[model samples]
Target: MPEPIADFYAVIPAGGIGSRLWPLSRADAPKFLHDLTGSGQTLLRDTWDRLEPLSGPDRIAVVTGRAHRAAVERELPGIPDKNVFLESEPRDSTAAIGLAAAILVRREPDVIIGSFAADHVIRPAHLFDWGVRQAIAVAREGYICTLGIQPTEPSIGFGYIKKSSELIVEGAPEAALVERFVEKPDLDTAREYFADRSYLWNAGMFISRADVLLAAIEENRPELHAGLIELAEAWDDRERRGPVVDRVWPTLEKIAIDYSVAEPAAAAGRLAVIPGHFDWDDVGDFASLTKLNSHGRGNDLAILGENARILADTSSGIVVSQTQRVISVIGVKDIVIVDTDDALLVTTSENAQRVKGVVDALKLTGRGDVL
Candidate 1:
């Protein structure tokens, strides 16, 4: 139909503590700041670059903790200083997104907003732009649009979106009405979902008008919405925005957007899933790193390894230092070898999934230096 609105805004939520990619991805330096792919660009920078064309620098906003504001600013220099909204303490995605909605709704009342993670990789900018336009079109019609990726395999690490009958959005050929939102399932359940043909991996990318999202928040989670409204009102007061965000953020209950809002909206038939036909990867943990890097051969060096023979059977392998340090491996397979300047990790690929456990142990044992 008509050309999509040129005044669309984007909000990136980057407040997570990234414990899974420990040692490298620390509390001070989240995964979004790390160059996980060994590409010069960090994940946050990559995402910003991808969204630049659609919303430009001034129109984009990043919601993160005060600890990460400098890093986020460093990653996205093109963004205006006022656009970087900072929370005093760490809050979950729901709070971060709600705060963003509150702030953006004030500036551009009818603006369509797109909320995405700072650490996902979706290739081919053209395809991503197209998908965003379609999502925006659906959102303009008062429907909360979420991008659901076609699962490449049975992945239990990610949540799934069950799609109902196809519905027509303005620009998209076919958009599926979201039937239900499923949490991370067991291996057997994941396989069953894969067999259904209607389930897609929830990409965590959402689009909707500011008012629509606020309405969804009000309907699904009244408490959260009330908190958001209070925060928004306080934010309007110049002296209060800074002090209030710092004071009240940590007190907000930690909940994901899916659990707090998306699931409820889907159940009420207010959510729709748009098929995103593009390469998508959350790069959530080191296991996900190997899966994304499966195309590389011998030249693949993770952290500090040289000429290392790494055969990742199940998307879990070594994360070595790339400082030209030589690390040799022979007859070793299905292992995660992480070499840092201070710490070394050698565990089975299966055990690699428990890196968060190591992070917790480090925290419990008061070894914050390594963490």
Candidate 2:
């Protein structure tokens, strides 16, 4: 049985459109709204399911764009209507999360709030819960705590967190004082970091007391903090929320929480990381998605949507076919074929990270229909 955390409030920032997932993930219908895992539920739905059990439905809130409000509501039916925070525009993670922290502070004053991205796919629920519990315990000690993923490979996709030694925080034996945050390193550097025991993948899972988080933002990103505070003060007032947010939200700087708070806070020794050994994937590209599809069960070909529609003959790689179309690949290795009704993408599984370039090309050609 899942018991609610005493003063814990969950904040899920479900804003990204996941341009790399292209035809499957669109602007109106973002990646978070889709079932990328084929787990019978959308990513946002899965995220809500994961957090609701910890914080209880009422204590969990979603911060998303106004454009996605209807979709978010439709997806998470149990979410309180008041808990849906609608942003005027895309202001990135800092603004979205700062807005949530401010609002939670307005109500509970010193509540514990954890911000998790909706698009990530984490497995072995119990392991994730344990790590989050540790993070929460560290957050209660007034540190901006993050759940750092133990790297299984020398993956360059994620930022790395360097740790010197463990903290003496009670109830969090695994928590470590973050030395510094290193950006996504090149292949050589990534390999070096992977070999280093102290380096952990920065999972971007932020847990902190509402007041502590806002104070960090005030010290690091004063401009964003000001706008967020104003928006938060108006948040409880239904009639004033739209007006004040419209006036102030666009003026806030567009920066990630990593830059606005995490790095700076870590420099001041205000950040701690609880190492998470659970299987975690941000699902940033098709290559990772293919790996997820091929997990546990061993098969020659990786099929995401319809296994019946995909036929492979001496072929290996990923195929995402969803148009009731028969896709047959013969003698091709490491090929990635994604078939949608309107747009089809063909690339090697190795070049999956470059899919964002294709999206940019479409934008340059003014192809909004498929974007």
Best by TM-score: 2
| Candidate 1 RMSD to the real structure | 3.3
Clashes of each: 5, 0
TM-score of each: 0.91, 0.97
lDDT, candidate 2, at 358:
90
CA error at residue 363 for candidate 1, angstroms: 1.4
Question: What TM-score does candidate 2 get on C-alpha atoms?
Answer: 0.97
lDDT tens digits, residue span 206-266, model 2: 9999999999999988877888888888989989887898899889999999998999989
**Where in model 2 is the C-alpha error above 4 Å?**
296-299, 306-308
- Which segments of model 1 are wrong by more than 4 Å? 1-5, 296-316, 322-325
